[model samples]
Target chain A: MNYKTVLTVCPYCGCGCGMYLPVLDGQLGQPIPDKTHPLSEGRLCIKGWAASEHVVSPDRLTQPLVRTGDDLKQATWDEALDLVASRLMTLRDRHGPDSLAFLCSAKCTNEENYLLQKFARTTVGTNNVDHCARL
Target chain B: MNLPQEVLTEETRQIVSRLLRDNQVVGVIGLRTEHNHTGPHLFTSADDLKELTLEPRYPLATICQAILSSLSQGKLGVIVRGCDERALIEMAKLTNIEMERLVLIGLSCSEELARQCRCRRPYPSHIDVGEIVEGVSPLEDTQVRRLLEQNVEERLAFWQQEFARCIKCYGCRNICPVCICTECVLKEECWVERGQIPPELQFHLIRAYHIADKCVGCGACVAACPMEIPMTTFYTLVQEKLRELFDYEPGLDTKQKSPITTTLEETPLREL
Candidate 1:
């Protein structure tokens, strides 16, 4: 009996198409386009329609995994971050900072992307920073 | 031109409150305004009737099907426009919804809304509220007329250009109320090649043929397309052909099987 649709924006891209995610008994349903939205006007791409799938998908990554002996094992955040930092430092020291490239995602906030590029340029000393949405 | 917005809302609220108070329905499905945002809601009690406001229509029939399948018993009342009613009828025929457990509260559309959609039948069969306005003809739409006037080569060229803009989003298929296939052929690699933008003409052709007999002309597909493709123009042409060949219209009755799905004896072709 508890059925309602929650209005939200699509998280897939910058279009920020308004959509509604129907919730029945607390279970999220498919996305429906918002007719009154000025930008999309009830239109959605495939990504918008399937935006909710990732939230409940079993295949979604929940924790960091580190490769050890050709097998990936779950690791704590600290462990994963330390490993990544050490590897990047080692690679930069030996191969040079330009050898490593930083790729950011559209899903990240503007601030987060700015921090990443800043880290790549200042900390990592590499100018090879790109974003998935750059195209 | 039409009933004032407040008058329509008040009348609809009164009917919904009565239904909830009398226990005629467990919940009434309608658009509700909350925090200055409107979306579908299941109002189980009359206390929330004040929030009910109708505008910027959604595919309520699809939502109804989802709710009915979850609930074991209880009659559900839904505020339906002409397109919702047609979608429900089509869904009932496809075994996606149970018509017996539904109480239809028909709300006729305004002439302006009908004209915007180029709707052929803007009013439901039974009008519970609002004035019944004249339906707009799709032939009057310049886009539909442009397609109709084109010859085979010109039509192909036009569609090729349109289809080229397609990002293979599948929004058209996903938003369709009648497309209830659990295993869609559009996903199969054998039918539609994967990882290809501007999918082959077969992708559109297969979908057109699949829904040719069942389309209710709700314009949901057109509304869901991000590329602004005029899908209704193509589907309207197919619907006209179906009417010419079989003398049948979809979403009019639950008992009328699609002429394409039925045997020749059951649904004979009309004399050309």
Candidate 2:
């Protein structure tokens, strides 16, 4: 019965169009463009309007996975993060920091992106940062 | 979208069924499909009311205007959401619809449905059916405000970038509830040249000015746009300007007159 609209910037591109992700009883209903949005002004591109599609998508990943031998197995956050951290450290130490590339995601928040880049540049000492929407 | 809410369907059905069986109006117009698919249907019999649905869609009042124009005389019943009711009021003031002959069966949309449409006023001012839910706050349009804040050159550049994506399908004009003209200026070569991909800025400007007074803020144009042009923001700006200038809000009350049609003596123009 509870319904709320969480205002967010579109993650598809740098355009940063504003949209409302409708949450109805805890389920993502649809994405609606914000009319008063300074940038987009209530108009949505195909991607912005269909942004909610991935939320409830059956094929969407529900858990973190780590590759084990040939097949990947679901693992807890601590286990996954530890494995990733150790693997990335080994790659950086052996093949140089530039061998590892850090990719930022549009799905991630601004703070998260900042943290990712800082982790890559300062911690891993790599400047190879990229974005999925680059294309 | 056409599927009735599992909780409210029975109550809504009973109301529609009674309205049809009692012959309150010659026909009751409502949605007849479900599951993100729907179209307006005019129910002439109580049996047809069985198919009546409350889909999260349908531009019923606009279709009703089209129907009303062809008919000489007939009382019509329409299932109206907040925007539909407002649009009908705007149309009636323009003489496009006969308000007196129409019976409105108002329905308050669920908050979830309201949020989906980005509706400011999801429920009609008056309701004849459905549980009354409080209206949610509509998101503000910073784009329009930013455009208004910009210098002429900056505004022009902004528009150039925005309209660059226009496939010029005229979905915004076609889907707009307020855009009921015998001959729209947008179609005219003098205003918008044929086969123009990113149409001349005048094309949008003309349409924007035309619906300024009448736009009910329905976001149908936005949804219909294949290119996903943010047409509603333009109309939203227009409506806001109309409100500020004339202190007249469209589709709020049937008795209220549209300043655009009224003489200056009746509704004096606001000072610039």
Candidate 3:
């Protein structure tokens, strides 16, 4: 009785298919396809249907990690980002920028992705930038 | 707004309101609006019955099945299309639902919808609303026919090309009403082999055989497939074969059992 559907685009792919995230009393329900959306037209791939799985998954990572010695220790965003930046700079300076590779996430925004490629090509001076979207 | 379809819908609303007030059912499962999109919803009180609708068809049986399984008690009603009623009947036969605790409010589809579904029997045998119209003759599955017509080598090549487009999303299995098992064979590495795109032919054939006798021809599998692989044609072909061999039609009568499940004494293949 307290059910609701939030219309949104699929977060997994660059296809931007519309879907409805059904919420039952605040819990995630199945994702139904957006019928009127021109791209999806009430059709969903397997990923679209199971989009709710990751949200409530107990195995979802809650924090970033930093390797102290052998084990990965939970760390704050600042600690993690600093570690990554310092490591990237050291790795780039030790062996030219060509040795450093940048990987972009499809889950991030276009602006965020733009920042990634720019960082790699300008700051890192590396053409070894890649995206998760194979196509 | 006194058009025939509108009048029937009004009657349905009145019936639902009365049912709620009379305590005939604790909840009514039907299509509802949320964020401007209409899909399956459970109307618990007569006050929320206004949200019920008949447009933008959905597989209400799936919703019904989900709710029924979650509940240990309580009777429920459904504003069902012919296809929905048929699906419920099939579910009842499979023991997936308790027929005694469920209410069926059958609604006949319009001529246009019948054409869209290419349905042979567009109207439910029972009626709670909407006038029964003529059922359309089933549209020929030209794709399936053409495949069957080819020589062995050509058939192999044709299916290879078709299956090659499969992203192996398994949308067909997820949306199928008959597929209620928790452990599906297609998911096992031993049976299907994971990490491979365009799943092996054994994958699809396994599913086709599983739902051959149980499919209600609701076309949800075809509608949900992202690659638009005509999944319905495969199931429809199998249904046609069942009709030819044993004269068994699923979702018709509760008394009639599937050919595969029935004993020879109860449902003989041929008359003496």
Candidate 4:
């Protein structure tokens, strides 16, 4: 009997369209545009409307996986991060910093993206910084 | 029929309050005004009646479907306008809603709102509170008339230019109350190629034909579209054609099967 809409921002892109996710009996429902939102003005792109699909999708990843031979096996966060750091260092040492490229996502926050580019430029010493939203 | 807006609102509130007090329904689903904003709300008690405000409309029928599906027992009340009531009837026909376990509180639309939507029927079957205003014919709209006047080539060119701005946003389909398919053909790569912006014209044509017998003229698709494509005008034309060909108008009677979905025996084609 409990039904309410939770006003939140769309997680798909940087447009930050305001949307309302209907919650019925603690389950997330479809997304609807927030009419009162000054920026979006009651309009949403395709991604914004389907933003809640991944939250309940069965294919969504919940844990990190490390590739071994051909298959990927579940691993702890500590193990995954250590593996990434070591592989990155080895690649940097073997190849020039210019060979390394950093690709950021619109799903990440501004601060997270900034830190990623900073790490690429300062720590790895690479100018190959790219973003998914560059298009 | 010429009552002031405030008087209608007050009358609606009193009726809802009475329904809540008498336990006619466990809850009344309507729009609740809060902080100068309004959204769909489920009023469980009479105390919340003061916040009930009806002005800017939302797809209340969709919310009603959500609530009714999840509700295990007891009947639920919903405030429905013409479009909402029509949508509910269509949903019931499709077995998406249990019409028996629900009560409809009809609310008539204002003439201005009716004209804005270009709705053919602005009021529900029965008006509980608000005045019943005249329905606006879709042909009265200049855009619809102009589009109708265009030849086949001109119409194709016009739609091509308009659909070019489409971002492939499914807002129109998502907001439609009668579009209750769990697996949509629009998402299929076979029907519509993946990663193609401004999807093939078949994308729009498929959707148009699918909902031809079910469209309730809610104008939600037009409002939800980011590109502001004149979808209502296009659907209204389809509706007009259906009327002329079969004398079939959807959402008017739940028992009457859509001419497209039925066999010749069930719903015979009208003489041209």
Q: Best by TM-score, which number?
A: 1
- Sorting all predicted structures by DockQ, with the top scorer first, yields 1, 4, 3, 2
Query: DockQ scores for all the models shown?
Result: 0.60, 0.01, 0.36, 0.54
Candidate 3 lDDT tens digits, B104-151: 788888877887777878878787787676765544546766866779
Off by over 4 Å in 2: A1-135, B1-4, B34-36, B72-74, B136-153, B260-272
What are the C-alpha RMSDs, in order, of all predicted structures? 2.5, 14.8, 3.9, 3.3
- The lDDT leader among the candidates is 1
Q: Per-residue lDDT tens digits of candidate 1, residues A1-135?
A: 678888899999877888889998888999988887878888888889899999999999999999999999999999999999999999999999999999987877899999999999999999999988987
Indicate whether candidate 1 or candidate 3 has the larger lDDT.
1
Give TM-scores of the second chain, every candidate: 0.96, 0.85, 0.90, 0.96
> What class would a CAPRI assessor give candidate 2's docking?
incorrect
lDDT of 1: 0.89
Task: Arrange candidates, best lDDT first.
Answer: 1, 4, 3, 2
Could you give me the TM-score of model 2 versus the true structure?
A: 0.60
Candidate 3 CA-lDDT value: 0.79
Q: Which scores higher on lDDT, 3 or 4? A: 4
Instruction: Indicate which candidate wins on DockQ.
Output: 1
- Between candidates 3 and 4, name the one with more favorable TM-score: 4
Instruction: Compose the digit string of candidate 4's lDDT tens values, residues A1-135.
Output: 788877777898888887778999999998878776778877898788889999999999999999999999999999999999999999999998887999988988999999999999999999899999997
